[model samples]
Target: MKKLLILISILISLQVQAQRTSAPEGPGSLTFWENLSKHCGKSFEGEMLNASENDQFYGKKLVMHVRTCEDGKITVPFHVGDDHSRTWVLTMEEGNLIKLKHDHRHEDGTEDRVTQYGGLSSNTGMAKVQFFPADQETTDLIPYAATNVWWITLDDTSFTYNLRRINNNSPIIVKFDLTKEVETPPTPWGWED
Candidate 1:
């Protein structure tokens, strides 16, 4: 009887461990764009307040729109109170890191700003954004590149984006917290259910 009880307990423990180690299904394991597609027909309203210190555009309201695309892409259109207009493309890459390409443009077709190559950190949720010189001949742009750390969290109904600008020279730290706007009618949006 003792042997049988011990065997049963060991089997139950192994089963529980297996279940715990199982991977998450659906959006959980899907690519960043694929996960965003789950929010199709939904809208996520949030503000991108400026956290830049010693800048006149501090505390400005920057609206964000996260729209789903059929080609598996999340279009994040953002405007910072007439000061800046840009769009960030978020796509999943190998090793589960999200690739980010930021394009700052004016009303015209000309490119006002460009981030030659930007991507999210592989191990962290922080954004590794960089700015390059207009001249393609240049090989390095580290002196001009700005690194920003950002954190994102999602609940069953809403999501939040917290961005902090890292100061490489000064001791002053800039931080911005943005919470999704909750619709009264409870529209389908964000990573919420």
Candidate 2:
């Protein structure tokens, strides 16, 4: 009976450890990623909530397509007016953190000078929100953007992408309505069929 009791306790401990590691709704969980993934393969139209006076995206048609999703990564193409030069890549890292990278390309399918600039999340953000401060790569590529911080928030009704430059008080916010699905835009630059 003593041996059997010890085995049962060991099994219970292992079970608990597994649950702790795999629970989706646990503290600092991957619920944010799961929520974002729910919209995989869908496209949504967005309105600019805020932008600077000279911003390129001002007064333009905004669209975001959740183009690709895999086990640990998602690719979203962000369209502004007729420009299809930007893609957002979200990757899950160890410890439930997510990294956001901006992949920029020219129409000729060549990478832009300021491509692949983004940062990793500091912690497992909430189910509906994740924040990524500019990483060293971004700072090195775009010196003025060293103080940039970008965040994405997703909820049942809408999803928002926002950016703030700490050094200057510049802000840009775009919100996409989840209640409606828009037509998927053409493949982003460099992602042609």
Candidate 3:
């Protein structure tokens, strides 16, 4: 009887573990972006300048804010220039895949440049971001734009950004790695350290 009871307990534990790791449906599917939103209140300082020029906007600081809404949409608000602020929406798609929609606009509600398609891949603590080609009608607006992938690592204190340009014809492409500075205190208002 003792051995049978032990086996039953083990089976129950295994079932619970399997459910914990199972993929959820709908809004629950965006677990990756949900985790990222936890860092919204905290600010990460980083810079992304022209890849070729490098010095044109070197040392310029940018703030990254990740906000997760109640409807399960994650918004990443990024400031590039002094007066430019862009927000990207991260949501889950049909095949358990994550999609990021870039909504770039001016302060007056005019669309500046919108790339409504982006791809996301996450495993463990690593993430990959891929920006898709712009829409057909808006091709002329963003001529120099091409699809690019960025590899990122997220941890309790900081995040790393590794950029890569993807090309089908080119044999050689460029890659750059940038680290963001994050300051997390020992304990915040509502949570324990």
Number of the predicted model whose TM-score against the real structure is largest: 2
Query: Which 10-residue span in candidate 1 carries the lowest summed lDDT?
Result: 126-135
lDDT of 3 at 43: 48
Q: Summarize candidate 1's per-residue lDDT along 1-193 as a digit string, tens digits.
A: 4554475359446534543565344333243234345554444445333345665445655445564454534555554555344655566646555555555565553565444334453442312121111222112433344454433433334444443334432222222222344222221222222
TM-score of 2: 0.84
In candidate 3, what are the lDDT values of residues 52-91, reduced to their tens digit?
Answer: 3444334444555554443546665554445344555666
Report clash pairs, candidate 3: none
Better of 1 and 3 by lDDT: 3
Which regions of candidate 1 deviate over 4 angstroms?
1-35, 41-43, 47-59, 121-139, 142-151, 162-193
How close to the true structure is residue 154 of candidate 1, measured as C-alpha lDDT?
36
Query: lDDT for every model?
Result: 0.42, 0.83, 0.44
What TM-score does prediction 3 earn? 0.52
Error of 2 at 191 (Å): 1.4
RMSD of each: 13.8, 13.0, 14.3
Give lDDT for model 1: 0.42
- TM for candidate 1 is 0.51
